[model samples]
Target: MKFFATCPKGLEPVLFDELQALNVEQPKQTLAGVYFGGGLEAAYRVCLWSRVANRVLLEFHRGPGETAEQLYQSVQEVRWLDHMRPAGTLTIDFTGQSEGINHSRFGAQKVKDAIVDQIRDETGRRPSVERLRPDLRINVHLQRGEASIAIDLSGDSLHRRGYRLKAGMAPMKENLAAALLYRCGWPDKAAREEAILDPMCGSGTLLIEAVLMAADIAPGLMRKEYGFTFWTQHQKAIWQDLIDEAEQRREAGLQQVKSRFEGFDSDAKVLNTARDNARRAGVESLIHFERRELSRLSRPTGEEAGLVITNPPYGERLGDEPTLFFLYQHLGERLKADFAGWQGAVFTGNPELCKMMKLASDKTYKLYNGAIPSQLQIFNIRQRAVPEVVEVIDVQDDSAEPAEPTVVELSNGAQMLVNRLNKNLKQLGKWAKRQDISCYRLYDSDLPEYAVAIDIYGDWAHVQEYQAPKSIDTVKAFTRLQEVVAVLPQVLGFPAEQIVLKQRRRQQGISQYEKQDQTANFMEVREGGCRILVNLQDYLDTGLFLDHRPVCLQIQQQAKGKDFLNLFSYTSTVSLHAAQGGARSTTSVDMSATYLNWARKNFALNGFAETRNHFIQEDCIKWLKAQKGENFDLIFMDPPTFSNSKRMHDVLDVQRDHVELIDLAMGLLRPGGKLIFSNNYRRFKLDPQLNERYEVKDISRQSIDLDFKRNQRIHQCFELCRTE
Candidate 1:
């Protein structure tokens, strides 16, 4: 008899080896499971002993099911009377698709009608359909035009294991846990009497699975029922004989077991569930469950080498991702500090969090937990290499310095970036110092391959990589980005921790202003003789716009005892400059309360009284329209290219709304007052009627500084005044 065993997607090789070990002949590999020429005894053995297999299936029939009629005819040929009585319960699990049967449910319904009609035609009775614990569970798979039909022998998806009465949030399936253990080489460590540990073990699924595999206990022993239990063809004596033999081996295996299994979680209630699960799995004494925080994780007592395996939360459903980064980082740090010389494995749905671990994985296996694609990252844990101590001699004379700078070796791409950075610093550095500009753009995609904007804000570097085109290979782009990050510290004289990295995609709505991280790490930087605070880590923007430096300075230079109005005033940087330039009073308006609060801080930072410099939290368009009659000598309106914030009454598209925005702002301007309008939309065009009506001078070139001269489209600035 030919049989098939279904396992997780990424563990086909492991399952193949397992079938061969069980003496199944001619095992062949497929997408999710393995096919083998194994008789009833071999199939039963797999059903009883296999740790990773989800179900053992007995092949019933195989044929083409191109059309719905063909599929029904093929299923009807299985002789339904031979497998189950007509009075029994039935269920069909259909997967894949064909030209005629495009839906799994429709395909399953056709297959079910075929079996029920065939049985009722001969026996005068039809089996009732049962989705759970059916007497005859049929699995039909259609690929291309072929349909492979089988009877599901092992039921309840083998991952149930008859344990885990209560599972924590987002618990991993037991079969997936076993597959991850196989990928992490846990069996070898167990054989050598090594220990296993899970720091974030929720409900003890990993611990229970490890103990069951190591103790020679059949995973299906505790199951009360299977698909074959009610089938008419089930051989009672043969199954009972296998069960007795397994019971005997389990008794002996428990006595000989020496490997330590331990699980730790922070939740006491979940720890109780884990202990109960271990007890139900019959390994309570062999495993230890403790309610210890992950931050307090340590190696098992007296164990030198073992495996530290865990399935940490992926932050997909429950936790915030930025906080989870620290969790993964702590897990890696704890493993390095406490479990050196051990093997470590982490299974997570979010692969991006793997980078936070900072451990080099020996291997990574892509698997799935249900529908969520996950990764099993395996690492050979070793002690962190101690830094070599070097004695530093203090120079007695301040003038005495190294005769020549040390040149470090780098990759070709990194060397190219280094040379470009040096050239830019040589030219822009002198200009920045001469102009007393502390914040400036050093390089903006100078090398097309390194498509990142490097901005220097005092001692820190904020690098924003433009999202590469889809035509570029993702891995190649990432490698180039890595080279850029590795080369920046050496080239720019800043430590790695001082550099903040972010990826910039085209902004939608107000998402560009959304906080990326909670670390409000602000640093003071000087520009245009005013003190400004820039947060490099929290948002995509650094609270200060480096490209708008010249424009803000122009506003300050023109504002002397003149009332100023700043609209869309992000962080109020321009308003602060205007206030410092001796503006009589300044009013800053924006839609974000966060920015308005930040503007309040900026005014406070500059020692400007909040009573004099007003920060209004309202939509700039609505605020401008609501003003009955207002007069300001200088009004600066710099709106986003587009804003569809939920707080806004309507969307603000610069190209479509610039004319109305300029006219509204001009209404608040006095007779001779200037309305400096600007936006970063590259294709923005001022209305010709506005130029015909008012005196408009395009100062786009003058608004750009020496650093941003190469990118003339950074922003378009126009000064509008009344011509009457």
Candidate 2:
């Protein structure tokens, strides 16, 4: 029997090779598939194991057909009853055009009519047309005056491995992903037990395909049915034997394959979907998916150097080309900085972006992602060594094994730290529950020996260890941290992965705003009618001030129908609340472009559509002097206590400069407006003369929430207005 395995263009060579590997007789390559002679077992094997094939077709007949009636007669000549029962569902896929049949759908209907009419005449019953899932699917092709009829052995396209539950913005098909890897020589690398990584794995499709290849697991094993299962010529015994053999090989392959497989995506949702897809693929345990940006991508430690492959977004919009260039450049920098002695493959639709990578391609293969032309650019990363410390910041080594501890489990200080955390959790957990709070501080340096601040953000925890004083013993501090890392996950019922650790130290001014790392791991937590995004890993502050919940709510309440102004707006969470409160217009001012951009995203997340909301990038103090015609009815001013940085021209000390700052800000307040001035400096004092100039009432105690009850001096807030 002559069979044909069809695939998308540019994959015919791989498909032809795949069929030969399956022991098909005299396989030959064609435009979009491979042609071969095969019987029941050979056909079943090709359908089950050919990753590059789109459909496996069993050719039955070919005849001359120039007109509709001639096409019908040609199709009628085939033995339709032997293949499909009268009550069975059938679908016909017709392609190409002829002199009499120009439209594909019209041609398909004529062929369908021929089959149904013949079957009905033979048994007095017609086979129904199933548009979606049919018991038997037929493929009819006509060009010039020739008609060829074949039964599709693979019901659905083999590209769908039945694993992907969700796709990212743009997704590459599984078949194309497999072909790209095969073109990159993944089979040879897997045989050598080398690792595979997709640094920009949006939905983990590439990594999932790579794992299937490494484990020798057949992709078709995940599907419950195929076209061959509904065929009359299919031998059930032979099919079951192949399935049983595949299962045994899958089990054994998983055990024998030690190659590390992993994926990284910047989007948390994308990473989560990747995990779900891997889980559904039955290879969840074989791969690692983590939330990470391309800029911070590092080498997977403790794994054999093999290949780094990715299909980054090829921005298709009018203005997307420039942004892709930036991304491509960043990707190249990361690849050069970390991945040494590894093969790299990047499949992208836009060739202009490839120029930004700066690395010359060792080999390039032409491919297509759907209709858009794409290139699979490959490069070889030569091994180079220089620095002892890797440039990647906060990089977690996935392959590292914990050392067997011969040291004591817990020291005297370690036990005290654990006990304090337990006491704080018991006390604060109840308070948080009663207050309807999703985020709060659990512990804040309860013991000087174990100086740590632990704050819970929904299911996650942010732990900041205060830089131990010089007088403290280094060994004890090390032991204290080791014990905390080991014990917190067990005591809190929260897994260790939920905890983000950082060292806390006093920054004299502008240093606090400096970026600790370029990696951005953002998550949103609910704060009273607001969903605020926080970056737990890349900054000194988690974007949202947990103690300032009351202030944020207060701003919202007073903002109705008012023109709101927010100064030194770290992330503009207060401005976001104001907009939620029906503010007529709101303007947020800050010096950091990063925070301003983040604030705009916050507004976008809340679906704020009005153009009245605005963000300005300028030093709050400098910008205040320029404010003349713009009068705000509600204002929030929360400046850093000390700021001496290169970004700002003026060095500011809030304590020494509070009077000028307050006078300038109040100048823009309308006649009946309110000004809320706040700062966290414990020793902050109000100017005596301002009391006579305006109505100032210290609302510090009322503004403090239960979470900060232990530290009442966490912030000082005042309601100040014109003394009308």
Candidate 3:
């Protein structure tokens, strides 16, 4: 008999090897199914032993099914009466489509009508249709104009494995579980009596599948039924012989299958279902199940080098995506610590979340669990090989101890660059941690050769390389940039993805106002008891200014119960701080609608979404001048020094406009209220006229952060109020 074994989409190659092992005559592969020449006995062997095959079919004939009449005629040519009792039930597993038959149920009905009509005409009796557990399941597939008909030798899908009692939230399909294990080299490991573990084994599907494969227990044997046994062509002696042989080997295989299998789940009830699932499969003794949290996962004592494979939650449930990143990171760190020399596989739909693992995997397979596309990333959990940090620059005078002979070779210039970055991070990183700071600038072009700023945001690093001067050689400049890119990930211990690279160039015209990207990605970072959102990408500048850190802190201390106005509020980071400090009302004015929307998100993120927090999208100068009756208790005006924005009626030069801008802001200030004006113009001269008109105090020294001490001219600040 010529037969076909249907498996999951990505398991074709796996099933082919399985068919070959079952002694089929040269199995030929096809989409989602494989074809082979074999008799009833060989088919029975496959139906019993193949772990990946979903169905076993005995193809009867192929012909045109472009029309209903033609489809019926094609299905009628098969000997239906021979495969089913005259009164036995039948069902059609119709797949694919033809131009004439678009509806699968309609096509199946037509095919069923043909079989019943033919069988009744021959013997005056027809088989009844059974949708569930049919004695004989016929497979009908029509593609274009051709139709292929077959009798399903195995009922239901072989993936059923007859073990699962309960499938947990987002349960992985059994066949996909098997494919993951196979891809991770479990079968080879099983032969060596190695161990297997699934830390997030929700209902223990992977654990049960592994035990069944190792024990040589036929997945089909658990269920005492087959589509072929009742068929007229089935040879009882041949079928019994296959079963008898499997039973004999099963006893011996049980002794040979010494590989230990265990599973852990956090939910107690779900863990119980996994226990029940194993009991039903009769491999409960071959595996162990426990209600254990993922953070506590560890290899069993005395376990040999083995495989750690799991299908953790993909965080597709609700908005749990971000939280799973930490879980993957923790799992990877624990695996590296405890399970060195073992193979690992993580099956997940969210490839972006895989970045948290920090392990490199060269082999990845694209597979599908139902409609969800996923990747099975395979990696070996061995010690990460640390490359020797080779020193390229001979900065040492003969007195310096020879540096370890391991640094990556680089030009003398690049070597000096890495050395300076290393030294800066050593000092800055220590102090930042001592101050409980998760985000801080570690290096700032301390060496002219490395004109890049390295800022640590949580576990990620953001590198902003200053555009080289025109006088510098273009090729050499690019080479240095590449060297910085290579050294940061190595020296700083961050994944390349975690390190965002952006070229910072002085913007002219309205180019600075344009959106670089629409990603709008923002992350909340803490500063002085308030959470502020920062976008490392999609902009020329990160939303939060590192140099203005102290200014934001001071705002929080002074903004209780005060009506606050934030002018030129790029992302409103300072305004958010004011709100956190119990500000009664806040009005943030900026020309860019994009920044206003970003500020709104920051408000929402900080749980400060009050009706009184207003975002005005208009030119700050225009908005300030339009305020006639309003007087604010407190105000922050941080204007750009030179903005030639087309959105503005007149370009702003802080040196020329500071007097008017500070005066307009002072006019809106109520009695005892303060106005803080700041700018980043290196040559900025605060009009002496403003100092004469109001009580002005230079707080520039007070606003600069420890990290920005070297670049004191980065920004300047002043506190102005109406003269009494």
Candidate 4:
């Protein structure tokens, strides 16, 4: 009568919404799980239609635990004979959080022993443990000394769905990949005249899910057995009725098949796997599989509008940054040149690679592949005319020595200037980093009035302070940025996306003599369950720094039973880690409501509890000024380099305000509390002006990364504690 549907950490809300849409009533959320009341028919329906759930579990019993003896006695109390015959095979799976149980495997063994012992004592025979396949599958969950037992209603994880008979290397699970497609707004209709394409379709999970949805085919139709079918309580007529209803729905959907679905993979073997998978799903006639490299892809004929969904490779496995960049550059050029009227969806673990596509995306959705948080960026490409190039005359180079170098007119006009800068980026970047200067002035001019600066860190570059010409006839700055990026791979041995561009715009209503201020644009990327906010192809100053990745992991490890407090929390990175780690509750405080809203999106993206985690839109100083006694067990305090928001009581500077902030934060910690304080202002000096009331330890060594190897002191971190 009662069941639980289990999903990955960040997909609970998606699964819950899906269940509600199916009219499954009264679904309750749990930690990394959900519970609902349903019959055998309902359970079977959920397995068939629920796209987000990993597995469906049927609850058997819940009782208080006394000891190992009590747990064994409780196991024997269940009427196992009602579901499993004495000669049938049985298996037990255990998950424990209670102090009474030290090992989940051991607990499972004990429960299995009790079940067989009871059956043998009563009937003279006991079921054997069948690991591969079993007649009955039981599940046990122990938390805070209480145990809840259940039967696994789905024989295998619901992701299997029985449709995938063949798979390629590193194939995504069917359920999760399906959820991603659904999130992208791919409708469930066959004859909509829209097309779906996966450029890098390893085993074609995305294409297969699309075809199944378009045909209104239930995923559970291919599976031969369900856990509920083995139960004595399973009513044949009820299951028959459910199957009949599903068949009617499928038949109604059969008339609507008008769209085309296809996938392309460079590997021939993977294409074969995709074809086989389609055949198993009975949609082989409706889907196409092709073997082609990304550069060789061509637009489908007579299609004015379509959706191009793809999962491109990140450089993590390839380890060649230059090659990766070229791949991205080619990909961008292909889309721009061929698919002029198509809307595209690109899913990538690397933000840098996404930038190489060159087209501006209208919407971005965040999802996870295992622990890696990733973005699914949607692009709407429309036909537009290319603008003609223009040239400008002599200007003085301000940075050059006396007898100022004259800017020479070049043949290709403005195009030559863009090409030269693109070439210089690669040449000068390697030279500057080798010289140990992270930031350097590239060009400065007052006549034409363009000041250019570059920040080089790791293998990436950030172009800052590039001002567009004020003349109304000048090309748009975005067009210039795209031009520079197109030649980046050739000049710098890096991809176009790896070179981030920041624009400088003149302030309105100001004197013509006033200098323009610049602001850098950064995109957030998700990798391995973590959200990394940074300027793609830019230097180390990511909006959300990755150096604190280890710190977030540490918080995840220590989150259970603790109330977490994150101060100056930009985008709530630590809070996400705490929630994923199973913390009781979390409160994130940041001065910027904008960053707080972004943090909330990250939580929603990862399926964290919105109510359990609160984002405070107030200055941490003001919030701290209003607080009194020690409360939080785990705290993260990372301040900005310098900020002067009018709503704040005082100007916030990390270097100048570290001591006072540390003291105030220490006073708010509970006994044995752990506080992590960090800052990115280079050449920072710790204040020696404060008393030693708390123990402080440097943790910067644990935060450095290979990707950020060029900057040795990019950020500094400290572990502080109040003395007992």
Count of residue pairs whose backbone atoms collide, per candidate: 0, 0, 7, 13
Write the candidate numbers in order of decreasing lDDT: 1, 2, 3, 4
Better of 3 and 4 by lDDT: 3
lDDT of 4 by residue, 1-724 (tens): 8989998766777788788877776898876767888677678789778877877888878876547877888888897888789988988888885566788887898789889998898899988998768888899988778788898878777888787877765567888787777766777323456887777788888988887777777777778787766766667787777788778877776567678887887566778888888888777887788766564666788776677887766645432343354355456666777778887778777767777566898888777767777777888877543311111111335586533222333335345655545555556566555644333323232113224444443445566555655662355545444544454444445544456665644322212112223333334344334433443322223445556766777888888778899998877888878877767678999866656665765564343434467889888888887889988888988887777766577878778788888888888888999888888777778765543667778888776544344455768888888777
Q: Residue 674 of candidate 4: its Cα lDDT?
A: 84
Error (Å) of candidate 4 at residue 380 is 3.4
TM-scores of the models, in the order given = 0.57, 0.58, 0.56, 0.54
Q: Which pairs clash inside model 3? A: 54-158, 388-406, 389-406, 389-407, 390-406, 390-407, 390-408
Estimate, for each residue in 1-724, the C-alpha lDDT of model 3 and write its tens digit. Answer: 6889898787899889878888898799999989999677788888888888899988879998998999988888777776788888888889888778989999999998998999899989988988887888888888878998988988877778778857778888787787788787787899999999998787889998898778877777776777875677777888788788878877888888888898976556787888899899877888888765554678889985988888876667512554455467656766776888888889988877777677888689988888778899988887743211121111335685533323467888878887887887888788777876767887788878778887887766788989999998999878878888777777877756557888888777577767677776656576666555677777888777888888888998899889999999988989988988877778999888777777765664444432457889898888878888546899999998788888899888888888888878888989889999999988988887777788989999999877777778889899987788
Instruction: Highest TM-score: give the candidate number.
Output: 2
Please give, for residues 196-270, the per-residue lDDT of candidate 2 as tens digits.
989778789888998899899998999888997777777899999999999999999989888888898646677
| lDDT, candidates in the order shown | 0.84, 0.83, 0.80, 0.69
Off by over 4 Å in 4: 188-191, 316-322, 382-724
1 or 3, which is superior by TM-score? 1
lDDT of 4 at 96: 80
lDDT of 1 by residue, 1-724 (tens): 8888898788899898878888888999998899988667788888888888998888878988999999999988888899998899989999989889899999999999999999999999999899877888899989889999999998678878898889988888888888888777777888899999988887999988888878888888888888789889999888899899999989988898899998987666788889999889899999888766564678988999888888877778645564465467667767777788999999999989888677999998888888888888999988853211111111134575433323556888788889999999999999988997778999999889999999998767899999999999999899988888888887888767668899999998979769999977766667776656678888898889888888888889889889999999989899988988878788999988777776765554444544357888899889988886657999999999988999999999999998998889888888789999989999998889998879999999998999998888999999999998
Where does model 2 exceed 4 Å of error?
317-319, 383-724
CA displacement after TM-score superposition, residue 243 of candidate 2 (Å):
0.7
